[model samples]
Target: MKDRVLDLVFLVGVLFKGLDGLAELVTGVLLLFVTPAKLHQAAGAATAGERAEDPHDLIANLIVHGVAHLQHGSIVFAALYLLVHGVVKLAIVIALLIGSRGIYPWAMGALGAFLIFQVYELVTNPSIAVAILTVFDAIIIWLTWREWRRGRELRTTWRGTVAWVFRRRVAT
Candidate 1:
């Protein structure tokens, strides 16, 4: 029962992560298209600041903005890869835990390392960190879905066992 509840929670977390990924992807794509001057104008409109009206300055601004977006996009892609990998690892760990007699210490260690990697990324490259986080989110979602399915199967099997036991008691 505890496992079932945990699986459900994981699934919800995964779904949220996927949504965050989609949102980042959209934002990155938009950044690629939007001009820096236009972005500045939008930003300035929201606050009192010296408006950049020079064309050259606008070009420089656009270049910097574009580069930032490119970097962000690359980071996001890397994060997506990591997330998928993490999800796969989690699923494998769960399988090993259930199908085998004992817990796999190595899998737990790997999870710990993965978590550390996430923390390191948070501290070092926070600007594009969302990209990595989103990727992990997608992986978590996938893992959650897998766990939910496995939980359903286990539940069904348990129900069958209970029914069989009830029948045997009645017969006795």
Candidate 2:
């Protein structure tokens, strides 16, 4: 029963990661074609009503302020970052979904590294989205570790059972 709940949570987290990866990939491709000026204009247009209603709207202001200072180099860097992040995430999701034991450590390591990076980002930028992502990554990391330990235990038990059976057969 406990394992069932963990499994459900893990499955939900993996699906979220897959969806986030696909969105990142699409956004990366879009970034390659869109100019900073265009992004700024779009942000302004989208937030026009919100800004009018409440000029200090946090989300709307953040979006507008962020794009207002955008640069060409920033766009390139963002695109590359998103593309790489998306690919890694999707690969991890695929392996885990397929029940690949070898990938358990690899996925945990990769996500641990990313979690560290996200922490740094959160400290430096202090954005709500980054904070949320950092927390989510932490949760995923915990789940992965738990699952890995569970898998290792199962493998160990299976091996012990097999060896015991082999010894009994030989004695008989």
Best by lDDT: 2
Query: After aligning candidate 2 to the native by TM-score, how far in Å is the CA of 124 from where it should be?
Result: 2.2
Q: What is the C-alpha lDDT of each candidate?
A: 0.50, 0.82
The TM-score between candidate 1 and the true structure equals 0.36
Q: Relative to the unseen true structure, what is the Cα RMSD of model 1? A: 12.1
Q: lDDT by residue for model 1 over 23-77, one digit each (tens)? A: 5455555555555555555554533232245535654555445544444455456
**Candidate 1 — which residues are off by over 4 angstroms?**
46-120, 125-172
Over 28-103, each residue of candidate 2 has an lDDT whose tens digit, in order, gives: 9899888999999999999999999999999999899989999999999999889988998999988776667788
In candidate 2, residue 170 scores what lDDT? 100
What is the model-wide C-alpha lDDT for candidate 1?
A: 0.50
Instruction: Give the Cα error of residue 110 in candidate 2, in Å.
Output: 1.1
Cα deviation in Å at residue 65, candidate 2?
Answer: 1.2
